[model samples]
Target: MDMREFAGSSFITVESLRAGPREEVVVSVAPGKYDKPVATFKSGDQLTLNKTNVRTLIKAYGEDSRDWVGCSIELSIGPTKYDGDQIESVVVKPISPPKPLAARTPVPKPPPPKNDMNDDAAAF
Candidate 1:
């Protein structure tokens, strides 16, 4: 269950992921189309392709998060097709995760020592 932050604009390809037969690909989204994928499966409902057919799939997902926006793209094997070495490698750039929110409360500073009480210690 690997999670990534998708800003709603990233190119992806099956070759880059090295997908194999009977493998499943899972995509999870938030408010925006660009939310990072939430899960991936090897086969079954979560699976999109199988050993028999490979198709070229290119799609995007997008969503609006408050003031921020996001989306993503997915490319897979098409019918009667296999991405071999002949096909140029599609460069899929990695997405960076969002930063943590800022703390609401302020940190307190330590109190300073009293000068009068330290006067005797300094005299010694």
Candidate 2:
């Protein structure tokens, strides 16, 4: 049995897409996502780039597919018209700036050591 059969959906989706618009590194470009040339991501999800998506990538990364490898792109679901019907589709967008690290909570300082002298005086 092909182990990849259980690897989940080969195509990326809004629900399956990683949280937020994280940059996805291109693993390879091949024909498979939908019988057409698709970009495979490091996560093993393949995305068939529509014309708009292709243009977006081209504008951001240029035309060379070889150059596309190792490059980052953000995938998100956007409204698109298909056969006169508006449907949600995977779209590629330029990677956004990395979010700033969350603020860390400062560790509380330990309480001052008890003064032995004070205890001795109290006992007197």
Candidate 3:
């Protein structure tokens, strides 16, 4: 059997969502599965973009899906109602700015080598 049998769904699933939010790099965004726009990740999982996901991605990256490639997004499970039943769904966490680098400690230079020759040496 192939991965499809093991994976069940080629798309990301709520049950597969990690305990903590995980960042995934976008590999490509294109029509997949049912001719709907899907965001494929470097992790090899694909997420079919719903209206909420589409809006979130647009707000984070831009209107152009092409620009979304190579960008990162945090995924988590959130509550949603489907068919009058509460269910967990994959939600894209809001994008946050990268933290600034901490100040580096300056390395001290070594003292210059001492002159080995004595001052009494004859001038040539």
Candidate 4:
């Protein structure tokens, strides 16, 4: 089975989030919102956030998801230690607000010839 459909890339957006019953946090991963949808992740695909990723999210978007309604989270699958066994787990990368692009001046275009005739050729 493709793990990407679960959580394996930087194409997840915080659709809605809430603290789970215990230490877990339920996060709805919605692709195609902030980034392109890969594999098959619907609008409300469930993704239980790992503790490490959750803490990272809190660091980036703050604890309350109300402050992160439309924030982007870059996640990827990587090696992680779990229960003394090495395993591939969903990883969270640093997330920061996008910076503004530098303003560019519009290039001037040469005006079209007054007449539609070829400049080098005379009308016959």
Candidate 5:
């Protein structure tokens, strides 16, 4: 059985930053592979993405786990070196968007047709 599952909370560290009198930000650090948190994949009853995978995803994405909450990273299996030994491992990669989002231009509305106003308009 893998142990990283149980080691999650153990290795993670949380820090609180005061931003205002009543506002604060909490930072949580989890086991990461590259420079990012390892991405966890849940199966029927198993979970994948170990420390290495988390680091790779962190590197592919970013170091801050909060920022990665809604981000996407691609993973692949490849050979990696560890302590002078080569072993197959999962790696995370960043995918570039086809194009950047462009600013939307508002459509010009046609000016109201010119018409004369009659004082009887209030009777309606």
Candidate 6:
């Protein structure tokens, strides 16, 4: 895509989780690859760009596990001054599977001893 357009500020499309809080996220401009600094964000964090910047959809998440819900994304670019500033905040709810319910079947109880085979309760 066009990294220049994404230079100012924009949201990232998290694809999968990587090492630490980092995750593989996609950028609107760089549709071919991902970006760098793979760090997570909050509802009001600033995403920055550095020398090791690349166009990749993968990023190292930090604390956006409750926001980026593995779905659509809406990049919000800040002013040109804070283009490469630290991500102020983000609102991404990580999409995760729901907790399991109860078990299907219960364990069966042992059968009682036969009257004739009973050692203690057997009648004469």
Which ranges of candidate 4 are over 4 A from the true structure?
A: 1-42, 94-124
Model 6 spans with C-alpha error above 4 angstroms? 1-69, 80-124
List ranges where model 2 is wrong by over 4 Å: 1-9, 18-22, 33-35, 96-124
lDDT (0 to 1) per candidate: 0.30, 0.69, 0.72, 0.46, 0.41, 0.32
Better of 1 and 3 by TM-score: 3
Worst 10 residues of 6 by lDDT: 54-63
Clashes of 1: 26
Residues 33-74, model 4: lDDT tens digits: 334222222333445456666666556655444443445555
Query: Candidate 1 vs candidate 6: which has greater lDDT?
Result: 6
Q: Rank candidates by lDDT, best first.
A: 3, 2, 4, 5, 6, 1
Error of 3 at 78 (Å): 0.9
* lDDT, candidate 3, 1-124, per-residue tens: 5464465436777777765767888889987666568888877888887667888876666666766777778888987667888777888764544222232223357899999989997889
Candidates' TM-scores? 0.17, 0.60, 0.60, 0.41, 0.35, 0.17
For model 4, what is the alpha-carbon lDDT of residue 14? 36
Q: Write the per-residue lDDT of candidate 6 for residues 1-124, one digit (tens) a residue.
A: 7555445543342222122133223322212224434333333223433322322111322222222223233333222223667543322222333222231223346799767765677577
lDDT, model 3: 0.72
Off by over 4 Å in 1: 1-12, 17-19, 25-27, 31-76, 79-124
TM-score of 1: 0.17
The candidate that achieves the highest lDDT relative to the unseen native structure: 3
Task: Tell how far residue 16 is off in model 4, in angstroms.
Answer: 21
Candidate number with the higher lDDT (3 or 6)? 3
Candidate 1 C-alpha lDDT tens digits along 1-124: 5343332333334454566322233343222233333222222122222223111121111121221122122334433433643443332211323323441222356699766755456654
